[model samples]
Target: MKLSRILKEVKINSIYRTGAKTIKKGGFRKNSNYDPDISSLHYRAQDVQPGGLFVAIPGLFADGHDFIDQARMRGALAIVSQKPVQSDHSVTENISQTKAKQIKNDLTVIEVDNSRKTLAMISAAFFQNPSEKLNIIGITGTNGKTTTAYLIESILSAAGLKTGVIGTINYRYLGKVFENPVTTPESLDLQKILDTMQKEGVTHVVLEVSSHAIDLFRVENCFIDTGVFTNLTQDHLDYHGDMDSYWFCKKRLFTEYLPSGRKKDRAVAVINRENAKGRELFEILPVRGISTGNSADNMIRPKKIEHGLNGIAGNVLTPSGSFDFKSPLVGKHNIENILSAIGAGIALDLSLDHIKAGIENLFYIPGRLERIAGNNGCFVYVDYAHTPDALSNVLGSLKAISQKKIICVFGCGGDRDK
Candidate 1:
């Protein structure tokens, strides 16, 4: 976009113009009112190029400002930063038409109070505000985010909405899937993905928002139409340092970011109230709260769940009505997952028939209770249970169905609290 349009309502802290000394008069636009064309935007200096804008974000380890010379080497058209970056940007031999004509000696540098927040907002502006075109659902908690996201996408898609998903496993849309290294991507990548989804006519997006993503400002400014809190457990204490701090980060999805005052009937917090933390959320959540569990009044309830190592079959009772729900997903914990999915379906205004169809239709979840068989008459299940709560649940389920001795093997990370 034209630099003028990009900066038009964007709040900036300061401005620094650094480059070869091409200035003849006032601001960079003094000579040419036509804004410099910014072809692409990035947060890392390594990704900067001739016509790109680089955002210098201060991180835990290496700070981005330290790499200004590297970005300038690749012809960074503009640099947005929080810390003062005093770089003597040497002249480049090859330059874009806009840069050659608009800037003679210096590069455009816009300083912002908060680079991370500005990166998110600027990305939205550059991408033409894609989140506005899609109904985004942000799911957060210690576990079940990936499974809940898969279940939500399935149900929403069955209801005739073109749905996309961003989860621990992958980011998928329109029959295409991309490998994801994190539960939520950085702000720039996220905006780009949402923009792509909007272009492909995707109407709904389900994202598994991680606590680190929230704390690190990775998901800033992205609109979440609905938020789901699966449940909180003791995990990520190393990063958050305490259970309260960790829970506080997850609560942002429901209390701070979710769309407010839309409708109390259309609940925002889809929670498993059976969990103590989830039950606490049900009491404080503002817009809407849809409880899911075996409780008498859970809007979506799992009654008499019949589950084993092979598969799960159960009765799902929602306020809209009850229906038979079954899934190849193993363990009783999956029953709560089913209830969470059903609650999401209800919140999205989907019919009971579609909800039941979506849950029963999904036969597998990769790396999550995935089953493997051997010819030697033994069964094996692969589960991504890294924390104490998750390991206990998986082992408990396996032991419940084993006719012989149940053996378990697990490990903890080197630096993490065990």
Candidate 2:
């Protein structure tokens, strides 16, 4: 893509051409007008290809700005940075001064105030803003995001729509599954994946939105059609510092991001009314809000529910209609997940039958209270419940169903908030 087109939505401070002095003024060069054709975008110096644009991101571990010469040596045509580009350095001091000067003279550097945000905007523009073309459901909270996302994905798939999912387990679409390194990927990788999904005819996408992703501008320009707030609990306090900051980060999904989605008229917030934080979020949502929980006042709730070791069966009541839903997912906590998914389905204008089928079709979600058959009538379950609230819910559910004693084994990771 042309450099100008790639940076269409980016907040550019100034653009400097080859051999051009760093202008003090904050604007494009009027005299030196050259928009280089960028082959690709890269944050790491090692990934830069010939004619690629390198974005220097200031990170906690290492700064990308320090490796600008390496990116240039790898034939990066343009450079994007928050700091002023230094033209005097080579990839190493071993290189002669003449070679360094020649390399600097052939490069184009674009300065911006925030490189991370700029990367997101430029990536969206370069990828033609793929999130805008598809209905995207963003699930955020301390827990239940993965299960809720799986439920929503199943519903969308039942509607005969091609679906894509990005979450903690994996990113899968069109029979392809990629391991997920993080709950939410960086903006460039995310945009590229969404673009590929759009090209493959995916009509709906479900994303697990993390607080870190929101705070770091990873999902900056992605248009979210439906935003689901499962529930906020005391988790990730180590990264966020406090409950208020964490809540604020989650609130941005509804208040700031949802308004800019393609389905502006149809944008909806699915909130867990049972949760105190979720209840507060529902009242302040700018878009249409669908309250979901076990309460009668909730827009989506499960009635005549039965929970057992086999699974959960219930009649889900939604604004559109009521339907009988069955799932292999056990526990009372899953009831909230199902309600959130039901609300998301309703917000997306799906039929009750489709939602019912979707809920029933999913037999299991990996590591979310997965049941394993054991010898001598014993039952073993493996679950990814790291937080105190999550563990409490899982153990509470086991205690409720167990005829005998329940043995629990768990380990906590080092350097995280307990």
Candidate 3:
């Protein structure tokens, strides 16, 4: 496809340059015009492939202008850059692109006010609206997004559909999983994952939608099918500065980012009825919502909460009826987790039996109430509860059943949310 063809489907400001003979002239092009078969669009020069447009975004610490020459050198069909336009001959000699072939590729560069948002839009067009074809579940809140996403993936997979999950712990697909250090990856990585999931016949993809992901527009233009709110607590103060901003950041999942006017019947929201923030989010959902909590007063309630030194048992109350189950996971917090899972299962039209089986089958949650063995009858647990509410819930649950003193040994990170 020609550059003119892509511009017709999506708006294009300018075409600064196009196909060159070699990397020195501009960059590598499989041919002359853009490739219609390209899998995805990317911003970083390093991620560029044949015919992909390399968006030169000005980052916080490093300006993307510095990498434009490199992206072109590496084979960017076009450059979406923020740097004040310098004549092609004026590229500073100080920056070297020896690895990008000879001289930096003098490809076409599109100037834009906000390239990040532009990248997202171009990606949506390139992917032929893949997000619309599948159920994209976005789980937000200070805590439990990852766990909730994991539970969603497990429940979906247990019901016999290939499920994909992207969160702090890892990005999962089929039976294979990759360790992901970030709660949410960049937009390009995210779009790539969505594309792969769609290609592999995945029916559902659960993503841990972080406050940062929302703020940076990493999930821009990708419609969410269902959004789940776990609970909001005192976290990310360093990034958000205050609870109000933090709450607003998490709220974007439902209020601002949900797909607009797309048959509200297909969209659903599952909220933690116990959390005030969750209630606020529930009020904003476009369609009818499901509420989950251990309290009997909850709309989608979890009853008969029983926890011991061994495991936890509970019954989930749905519009249909209640289904009892046992979970190897312990704590009232875990019960909250189960309730959220049940709500999601119902939202997706899964059977109570399948939901119960999925919840019960999940015995391990890494670094989350993760227990360790010892010689004596004593127990040691390692958890990733970095927030006040998380610590309170875990400690509160253990305190309820302890025959002896329940002592907590903990410390905060050096430069993190202390």
TM-score for each model? 0.89, 0.94, 0.87
- Looking at model 3, the pairs that clash are 16-108, 17-108, 26-105, 26-106
In angstroms, give how far residue 37 of model 1 lies from its true place. Answer: 2.4
Per-residue accuracy of model 2 over 162-272 as CA lDDT, tens digit each: 999999999999789999899999999999999999999998999999998999899998988889999988888788888899899989999998986566677889999
Write candidate 1's Cα lDDT for 1-418 as tens digits: 8876676656866565664344322334644533578999988888887888888887878878776656766777788877655434423234445543543435677877888888888888899878877888888999889888888888987888899999899999999999998889999999999999999989999998999899987777777777888888888877899998998988877776764423324437788897998988888887777899897877887777788767888787788988887788888787778788888888888899999888888877887788887567877778889988888888888788778876666665555453
In model 2, the Cα lDDT at residue 117 comes to 90
- Candidate models: Cα lDDT each: 0.79, 0.87, 0.73
Residue 54 alpha-carbon offset, candidate 3, angstroms: 0.9
| Superior candidate under lDDT, 1 versus 3 | 1
Query: What lDDT, from 0 to 1, does candidate 2 have?
Result: 0.87
Ranking under TM-score, best-scoring first? 2, 1, 3
Q: In model 3, which runs have C-alpha deviations exceeding 4 angstroms?
A: 1-40, 82-84, 89-105, 261-265, 294-297
lDDT of 3: 0.73
Q: In candidate 2, which residue pairs get closer than 3 Å at backbone N, Cα or C atoms, i.e. clash? A: none
Residue 335 of model 3, lDDT score: 76
